[model samples]
Target: MKKLLFLLLFFPSLIYAQNKTGGINWISWDEVEAKMEKEPRKVMVDVYTDWCGPCKMMNNTTFSDPQVVQYINENYYAIKFNAEGSGEVTFRGTTYKNETYDANKAGRNGTHDLTRAIAPVNGRIAYPTIVYMDEDFGILSPVQGFYKPEQIMPILTFFAENVYKDKTWEEYTKAP
Candidate 1:
């Protein structure tokens, strides 16, 4: 009887302890769209490819930061998108696919049409693009490259707070 009583009290605490972590709650694109339809919120899409080293680094460090995780969870619907993976993903009324994907291919593979349409920087694509979108799912910007936790915080805030509407990136970053 004592063991059963102890088990009942301790099991819930153990589950709660395991649940706490500095991790972003990543969701699928379809889930994001459905949730936003009922209640709108900003979106952050982590566009990554399997062979990208920097992308893995950000996942280990920047995205793992407690502050970043908390802020994103509170303010945005996050999506971890595989830029080279196979699939048909429709955004803004258009469907996209990776035409050159080969199952046998090892390291690097074809870029998805979704990546070209959303994550390009000056007509070129790069991995680890942190794409921010508005509450309506309009593309605010695609911030490409790896960033440290502190470095990414301001960028996250700028989009979350809608500061981009009033100030340029330079102006927003310059302010105290």
Candidate 2:
């Protein structure tokens, strides 16, 4: 009983701390917009819904790793975006809103206009979508589902190194 009580108290705090570890640099949409107007860097958006299991997994696993955080912080401006929130977002001269969402309900929320405009052409719109973009806000890739730190390292590195500039992922991965 004593052990159970101790775990109940300490475990949650540990989990919370672990969840906040990774990602080198984090900024708000407003900051990203303002910076882009002056100097542009690539952006990474973790587009997730509050109730998504995989999204939570990302918070618990990938983001918690210090190495992962360090890499991201150095390379990109990371943004955590809720797909169903009452926030006004402006990207590339267009404004997006959560006009159709009623967050009070279960499993039903209006997607932002920005999400609609930038939906992946492959049509794999799932929970825990991580969108990568160039400095110009051009969509680079949309990775869906849960990915651990190991799984995401290459993708993260790919964007960081600007391999997308001269070659595709297939071409880049094929060499060496």
Candidate 3:
């Protein structure tokens, strides 16, 4: 009777824990550089503004998806960067900072220099951009928008496995 009661009480929680994604192991930009020296891995930067709704949605949904979390944790160094943050980040001998940040503002604050450096789309900053970089910190791509787990798996695999080298995206997607 006690065993049955214990199982009933704890089993649901155990199942929930197992089903839930453990979430990405995010590192700082500085940590990525440091880690690269010892062991190189692809880097995926999630550039988001705090005020952006889609950014929040992506964080809660797509980023927390089990498959997405597992693939990213296994293949890349994940970074979560606030685009409007005022912190200084030094990368590849260059210092990036948000000099024009205004705390009093709502919706849009000043942009971080690192955000500009990574996700520059014709001198504009977009929320929820995913920046992919090579092991050496070279830019591979900057994908903007909120992507579901199903939507993002292909992108993750393409970069993670270096499938972009020989196969075109069209070709890769068509493959059985």
Which candidate number maximizes TM-score? 1
Writing each residue's lDDT as its tens digit, candidate 3 over 1-176 gives 99999999999998678656467898998788888898899999999988899999998889888888899999999999999998999988999999999878887888898898899766667889999999989998898888988999999999989998889889999958
Error of model 1, residue 43, in angstroms: 0.7
Clashing pairs in 3: none
Model 1, which residues run further than 4 Å from truth? 1-22
- What is the C-alpha local distance difference test score of candidate 2? 0.81
Model 2 earns a TM-score of 0.81
By the TM-score metric, which is better: model 1 or model 3?
A: 1
Cα lDDT for residue 14, model 2?
89
Sort order, TM-score high to low: 1, 3, 2
Better of 2 and 3 by lDDT: 3
Give the per-residue Cα lDDT of candidate 3 at 138. 91
Q: Which clashing pairs does model 1 show?
A: none
Q: For candidate 2, lDDT tens digit of each residue in 1-176?
A: 99999999999998777655534467888898887888788889988888888898887779878778878877788998888777888877778898887757787478877676665547656778889999888888888878999989889988978887888889877858
TM-score of each: 0.87, 0.81, 0.86
| lDDT score, candidate 1, position 106 | 96
Residue-by-residue lDDT tens digits, candidate 1, 45-88: 99999999999999988887778889999999999999999988
Residue 147 lDDT in candidate 2? 90
